[model samples]
Target: MSTIQKDSAITLHFTIKLNDGSVADSTHNMGKPAKLIIGDGSLSDNFEQCLIGLTSGENKSIELKAQDAFGMPNPDNVHYMDRAKFVGDAEVEVGTVMAFSGPDGAEIPGIITDIAGDSVTVDFNHPLAGQDVTFDVEILSVE
Candidate 1:
């Protein structure tokens, strides 16, 4: 029975729920468990700490604050772009998520939050930002 440690390779199923009790994400919906190595930058330190001593076949529910979960939404992440930039077939409507090239050529996903004349407001913040969340986890294996 291996306990989760700093370098442990873990396999688990997780369900992330928002404060409103709506499901945000779940490996169960994907029909497969997720695997990860601790301290690999895939999860925040606060999130990983919750699994410090957990072993196989354990079930745990962890509650996280807004800041700890995804950090509060940053106002700086909101930008106004020219509506003309959204040309072609894609519809330009509020609540639409679109990806654009970043400075490093990586795709940055932004959600359209507003549209006014030639100005389109795009928010780059994580969709779950500023919301407290709960993680329901079932540890399948730890090595």
Candidate 2:
């Protein structure tokens, strides 16, 4: 009978839906739950706030704004890289997702925004950036 609080290990089945009620992601379909350590950096503070008071076997839905969700897309996040970088056989087509090294040594997954002549434009922004999303959570366990 543990309560969900900061530093709690929470297990939940969740479905992320858009404002239009379109399912973006769902763990319920997989028949397995996901666990998140409260206060972890994996989730934003706003997202964590929504789960702070939930108990086991609870169901809740929370709405998140663009900023509170994936955050607003920054113009600077979009970059144009040399086409030579993509020497592999994978089609360098627009809308393709690729991973590139970031300044912090993390692989930043970027979307191929454009491909012209010798320059292949890549956007390093999160795919869901600037999008307002909703989280539909079913608290499977809280400890």
Candidate 3:
């Protein structure tokens, strides 16, 4: 009967639904419960707050504002790249998610938002950014 607190190890199944009731993500879809420690920097502070005080075998539905969830889309994250950068078999089409190397050499995923002649607009913001979401969580264990 451990209530979730800071640094608590938690095992849970969660479904994230958009405002339109569309399933955005779900651990159940992955066929396994997710395990995480509170304040591990994985879940945002606002998201982690919703789990506080929850015990094992608890079910809760939490609604999060766009800014509180994945957060509002940052205009700076939207960049316009040269169409020439995309070569070879890669299709230059809208709605395609591509991974680009960051300054640190890490792969950063960006979605093609627009294509205008030689310019291609890629949005690096999270796909769910700027959208409010609902979290349905079933806590399997909390310690």
Candidate 4:
């Protein structure tokens, strides 16, 4: 039974829930476990810290503050792009999620929170930002 530590490869099933007990994300719903290596950039350091020392078959519900989970939303992350930038049938309506190219060629997903006249407000903040969250994790394996 290996404990989760730096550089350890881990497989786990987890769900992210909000303070209201509303689920934000869940691998359980997807019917698949998530696999990741510790120290990888896939998860925030604060999130990964909660998994330390957990062995196989262990489960825990770890609560995190807004800043610790996803951090408070940054006003700078909200940008108003020209409606024309949406192109044909790109779904620019409010609540639509779209992917935009990042500086390093990564696909950054943004949500359209508002549409006003010729401006479409796209928020690049993580959807759960500014909300406290709980991680319900079931450790499947650790290596």
The clash tally of candidate 2 reads 0
**Which consecutive 10 residues in model 1 have the weakest lDDT in total?**
62-71
For residues 36-138, could you state the per-residue lDDT of candidate 4 as single tens digits? 9999988888888998899999999999999988999999999989988889767668999999998899999999999999999999999999999999999
Candidate 4 root-mean-square deviation in Å: 1.1
Per model, state how many residue pairs clash: 0, 0, 0, 0
lDDT of each residue in 2-88, candidate 3, tens digit only: 999999999999999999999999999999999999999999899999999999999999999999999999999999999999999
For each candidate in the order shown, give its overall lDDT on alpha carbons.
Answer: 0.96, 0.89, 0.96, 0.93
Point out where model 1 deviates above 4 Å.
Answer: none
The regions of model 4 sitting more than 4 angstroms off are none
- Per-candidate RMSD, Å: 1.0, 1.5, 1.1, 1.1
**Model 4, 139: alpha-carbon shift in Å?**
0.3
lDDT of 1 by residue, 70-131 (tens): 88999999999999899888999999999988889999999999999999999999999999
Give the TM-score of each candidate.
0.95, 0.91, 0.94, 0.95
Question: Which ranking of candidates, highest lDDT first?
Answer: 3, 1, 4, 2
Estimate candidate 2's RMSD in Å: 1.5
Q: Kindly state the number of residue pairs that clash in model 3.
A: 0
